[model samples]
Target: MRLAPDRRTLLLGLGAAGLAPRVLAQPRFVVPPLAPLRMEVDRITKITVCVRPFRAAGPRLDVERVAGKRVVHNYGHGGSGWSLSWGSAQIAAGKALEGGVKEVAVIGCGAIGLTTALTLLRAGAKVTIYAKDRAPYTRSARATGTWSPDSRVADAAKVDAAFPALYEQMARTSYAAFQTLLGLPGEPVAWTDRYTLFDGPDPGVTFPQRPTTVPDIRFFGVPLRNLAPHWNDLEPSQHPFPVARARHGTSMQFNVAELAHLLTSDFLLEGGRIETRTFNTPADLGRLKERVVVNCTGYGARALWRDETVIPVRGQITWLAPQPEVRYGLYYRHVNVLPRPDGIVVQYGGDSEMWGYGSEDETPDLAEAEASIRTIAPLFEAPKA
Candidate 1:
């Protein structure tokens, strides 16, 4: 999306609030059409951020002994499904590859399943995806496409043994793969700077922290009172709020709808087969061939596989009119103000928690959405009074 001088300048300039004025003269963003979704120009003065908690889905797939056939489990990626899918799928598929299988059944059609299927196809194997829902309907499309890791991947110890190393290797690989997609035909992948404002004493809390094993996770930690040349330090005159401290960093954002459609097109072009089928029970999977089965079902792993550990950290995002001028994103405390092409998605992640995560029988709560917008309205720079 193309940003106006005021929005772009304010964002980049604010990021360097403590720096010299000469630095502000540099052009920050190249004006581009808001395309595809057809967003319009608007001034945003505040934003919100939230913790999109991630949990495992259902019981772990019994790879040890699954009806005497090779099995690889690749589900349970919460909010990080699209972010971590490709890398995780590679590791899971590699495990399945050891059995010399030429055909595989991939369950789930979101980014994870799609990436897994693509990985298998590249590895000289025929792939078929079984799922209850496809792309736009899948949870993957609902994500705010940012390249931050560990947001929804399970905790370190909770993951399987082979998963750790595989997760690391796949994360690096996936990051590199996405780097290739940077500024593609659709500008599918792009970079944005975000500011996290901190006010008051240091209770010491942070977002989407990665488990002990993940690598290359970038974060800027600063004291609540420290003032420096960059975003961490703010002069008394530049302080946006009565804040004791704040932090800032570069973040990667992807257009989920465009990226998903691009991947789906690629999948079909490669002759990949997709079967729309939903499984109510593990036995329901018996209908498929006796070959390797890779489960990519996000929340469905619970009921279908009877996973009691799976929990739903319900998030509600309000789609307000788009603000094409707001190219950069803003995060303060737990609420994030993400500017998407479709609309401005204001999300609240911590207010409510639900159990049956995989259940598609859920509906959006409009009241929750309005309440969240109200809570984070103060963060926008030019919000409507």
Candidate 2:
């Protein structure tokens, strides 16, 4: 005979008895005001190109002994250099400090290099960055500057089993680091609304009815779609887009110019030094007086160390005159429209995410820019109901 049901047992019995059906409240979404995009092609101010250092095996963060000095590799972030800069720098700086070195040398002055130098300085180490080019002039400045931590970060097949968890850690670390810069004088980093538009049911959208075993060798350790916090699905009537579906989320968009200035200033103020010099080979690193060297050379790492795995993923952006009225970003028809403090950036996402792989062509195509503008201009032409 069973004893009288306890509260816990009674709840289990009630659930098994189907006494009540679980009901969840449907979320009420608010529709934002429709703002027409300013897409005048004639107002285009500038065009810039950047090459992302994509490594199929993911970023190289291992330590090596070179010329009797400790060399910490911290490059090869692919499209995520801007997104993962701080976190990756932290890892590199920690490794550099493993032996408790008092001084550190950072090669390259892009996002990764500057952050690494700053990180070392914060940790009570004398830091110096040696590079041919600096921020605002480096490839990092040309980035679209969105918080996309896993965008082509690695090829799943090439990464190890532990990479996803590690990637998550770095992504979270970088996110937290960027938060400290928000609302500062230059507004280096700020939250902005991003809308992913769909003409119909987006072919890119996938709904897994059941969990399928994903192979370990994938570009992302975890899918980027699952990482963003303020992501929401909206009905056509609940969004400002003319499209059938719009995925809305809030992301930290960096004003590259202001961010570079801020990072450079912060690094200098913290006693970090910058040396404008170029290195042709890994052997050149030995010339530096510091016993520990952190390599943040980005794509230059491909040639400096002769690493064949580094691939160039070229990206171009067309800037239109500043449009203060435009506060949101939109990705539609493989075109990205991002409004920032400096200018409005319009870029092509290409047929696939890896469309420009291995291409170093920096030349900006005006015809291509015009075509991208035409594709999304119609959305603004439609009258808001």
The C-alpha lDDT values of all candidates are 0.60, 0.82
By lDDT, who's the top model here?
2
Count of backbone clashes for each model?
Answer: 16, 3
Stretches off by above 4 angstroms in model 2 are 1-27, 200-218, 224-227
For model 1, how does the per-residue alpha-carbon lDDT over 1-385 read when each residue is reduced to its tens digit? 3423655466567668664343344343332332222112233322322223255421243364455446677776656667677777777778777758888888888888888888888898888888898878887777777765655455444555665555566567777678777887766777775556565323233333212322322221112222112344433333343345555556678787788888778877897888889888776666788478887776677667676565554444556777666676655545566766666766655411222233333455554455555555544433221
Residue 21 local lDDT, model 1: 41
Off by over 4 Å in 1: 1-68, 155-166, 200-245, 351-361, 380-385
